[model samples]
Target: MKIKEIQDEIVEEFSHFEDWKEKYEYLIELGNSIELIDKQNKIDSNLIKGCQSKLWLYAELQNDKIIYTADSEAIITKGIAAILLRVFSNQTAKDILNSDIKYIEAIGLKEHLSPTRANGLVSMIRQIKYYALALNTN
Candidate 1:
């Protein structure tokens, strides 16, 4: 789906939840659903840069698309990471680069986050897009 379509769907899905607390709980549940990466691929060197919490993000090129897996020391951060992964994973490098992630703020995730958390989320998105660029270049 296009990013805008995906954003709309997420907004519609979360609209049913009454508050940010429940939305966060739902996000945590979504995080738990992401497949865990292998221990060998989960090295500290793969950790996202600029995040206050330790966050490991691993990406690979498959069928000319990027597949990402991530884990975070903080639950809420993990959920945020998962949300990003769900949005960009399995997409072509061109698609990812062309997409506008700013919709995340419009979707209410960033608004509820603290300044530090919002920065961390931005860092994670940058890291993922960097990986996509590397894949595209190679």
Candidate 2:
């Protein structure tokens, strides 16, 4: 699906929950459902900086689409990354770079997160974009 379409779907999904606790449980579920990254790919180079928890992101270009795989020591972080990968993965580099992920704000996730996790989220997004930028040119 297109990025906006996927994001809108997420917004709809989050709207079903009335409270943060339920939302958090949903996040855990998303994290658990994330496609597992290879153990070898979880290396120091893939680790995203600025996150309070250890988070690793690996990306590769496959058939002109970027595939993202991530893991985090913290469940919430992993879940957040899963959300991001769900939106950005299997997409063209330009599409990933140009897409605006407004669902984060629309779902009120950023405000509810701890400041550190919020920063981690930003870092994760930035790193994903950086990967797209680097790979898009090739």
Clash count list over all predictions: 0, 0
- lDDT at position 40, candidate 2: 95
Best candidate (score: TM-score): 2
Looking at model 2, report the run of 10 residues with the lowest lDDT sum: 110-119
Local accuracy by lDDT, each model: 0.77, 0.88
Model 2 / residue 70 / CA error / Å: 0.1
- Among all candidates shown, the one with the greatest lDDT: 2
Candidate 2 matches the true fold with a TM-score of 0.93
Off by over 4 Å in 2: 112-119
Note each model's CA RMSD in angstroms: 2.2, 1.8
lDDT of 2 by residue, 1-138 (tens): 999999999999999998999999999999999976789999999888888789899999899999999999988888898999999999999999889967999887866344454437888888999999999954
lDDT of 2 at 22: 96
lDDT of 1 by residue, 1-138 (tens): 765677677778877988888988888897787656668888988877677778888889999888988887777778777778778888888888888866577667765345565437777778888998999944
